[model samples]
Target: MGLQVNIIKKLPGFELRVDFKADNDILGFLGASGSGKSMTLSCIAGIVTPDSGKIILNGRVLFDSENKINIPVRERKVGFLFQNYALFPNMTVEQNIGFGLLKSISKVERIDKIKKKILDLQLNGMEKRYPYQLSGGQQQRVALARALVVDPEILLLDEPFSALDEHLRNSMILQLKDDLMGFKGTSIFVTHNMEEAYQLCNNIIIIAGGSIDAIGFKDAIFNSPPTLCAAKLTGCKNISKAKKIESNIIEAIDWGCKITFNYEVEDSIADIGIRAHYLEIMVDDEDVNTFNCWVVFTSETLFRTKVYLKFSEPIGDEKDFDILWDTSKEEWDLVKDKPLPLKIRINPEKVIQINRN
Candidate 1:
């Protein structure tokens, strides 16, 4: 079964127009805050009504604008896992899971089915526990079990692991990935984390300014984003303006010198963006595009080290650039305060030069 969304809505000072399709794959909606990612999910879940268009799930028309066909949320057979876990506090875990099955099956049958689901989610012994009794990870698992207990046709998870600690979040993400194995139905997962989006979804859709900026396979969308905004959204920290010098060469004038890259720019306005990981820190040598840069500052992160550098001379009124390096603690310490000129390797394709109008 697949999910299709062709919808339009006009919000205060913003218009959301989204069109996408997904098969049984886990599709991720990636966008920054206020970019309408959450709003799109709400519309699909029937929580927000769209001004126009249709939503179809598994051949069932859930919302059709022309015919005024809109299904109630209860009848949609969609399992929505909210960001807050949203477990009913008054009811025990078992009761909350079995709540939806009451009308479909007898008490005994519902209890038995819920018990199986609890075991499936590894929450068997937590049956009588309240929401307050479980840890964040356990509570999230219970929430998933509760959603699956109803045997919903599709699963919609909205920032499912945002509330957990780092360790717990990673563990829960792995668990969720495992749980999706037997789920043949489609899933729409919403998140702002680029790593999470890349790790979880087969197809990634990025939204910006209430519209789709880019959408494709995880690698394609991140590695070759369609616009400067898309590159920035996908964790590109080093972006510079460039002008075409020849057919297959573009010169970045702002990066200390006229660094010619092995890329063609047909558009008059072109911007090149490179991820920090792609940058290097070493002495400037005979490398084709090498330039002199001085280390101005350095900082360390959990997994990588970052160093900010400034150019020897101003170029196009731009004074400096920052280059981040991902290295071990020992490696970072060796160059902690050293003044060095670095040669950075550039992959022509990875260095995205966006054509702006």
Candidate 2:
């Protein structure tokens, strides 16, 4: 089955207006904090009421503001995995998982479901332990088991791995990916981590300022973000104000550079974006779109080096308008002993045209 959401809710500083549809594939809501990603999920789960619009899951109406029909939270049949894995502190793992089924199921059936869930989630031995007594990974598994045991029609994960350490988070993501293979219902994953969204989601909805900035498949959205906010959210490091100079040319004002495109340049393009990795070191100054930049600073990460460079010409009074260039350690090592002033070329095909009005 699938999900259809078109809702509006008013918040203190912003108004949440989202409209999207997704099938059984995992959909990721990618946005920064205070972007109303969690609020959208809450509205679908019936945890919060929306000011207007509709929510339909598998042809079943969950909320409809016009009809004044809002399903109760318990009756929505949605599996919500909170960020903190909200498990009852006093209950055991088995009790927590079977808690949702106790009302409508017999003791034998409830025990069978709990046993199957524990086996499915690989929590067989720690069935009697409480949430505080288990490790982060184990606790996450228990939360997933509890959510799935009720046979919910949809699953909503709100930064499910945010509470875990890096090592545990990676391991649990692998485990969760495996577990999701057998889930028959639609799943919505909410997170600000671009890498996580790229790895797990088939479709992505980017939220910015309490609205959907862009929505598309994972590869398309990452390769060509439609807006300035989308580009920044998708990890584009270099963005500048652009003015269309010709049918296939645009002047990047902030970087003091003019870029020519092989494709048709739209008149509505207001910004230009280039990924850090897409820029290459130029061997000669005659190359197209190549400019000499002053090296401002350099930093190292686990596997790559980040070089920050400033344009030769300053734009207005902003002297710190720098472009970030990312290169592999091996590549950087080859150019590490090179001279101070470096010339870099921006790949024309890698240049992203953004329309953010």
Q: Which candidate has the highest TM-score of all?
A: 2
- Which window of 10 residues has the lowest lDDT sum in candidate 1? 313-322
Report lDDT per candidate.
0.81, 0.90
lDDT of 1: 0.81
Model 2: CA > 4 A from native = 313-321
Residue range 1-357, candidate 1, lDDT tens digits:
599899999989999999998898799989898898889888988999999999999999999999999998878888888899889999999988877664857878887889898988899789899999999998898888877887888888999988888898888888999998878888889999888888889999999989998889988888788788778888998888878777767777666445555554575658887787766555556676655666555678886677666665335645355554455667667766655555555556557767875
Tell me the tens digit of each residue's lDDT in model 2 across 2-37: 999999999887999999998998999999999999
Q: After superposition, how far is residue 135 of candidate 1 from its true place, in Å?
A: 0.6
> In model 2, what is the error at residue 220, expressed in angstroms?
0.8
Candidate 2: residue 178 Cα off by (Å): 0.8
Give TM-scores for every candidate, taking all chains together and pairing residue i with residue i: 0.91, 0.95
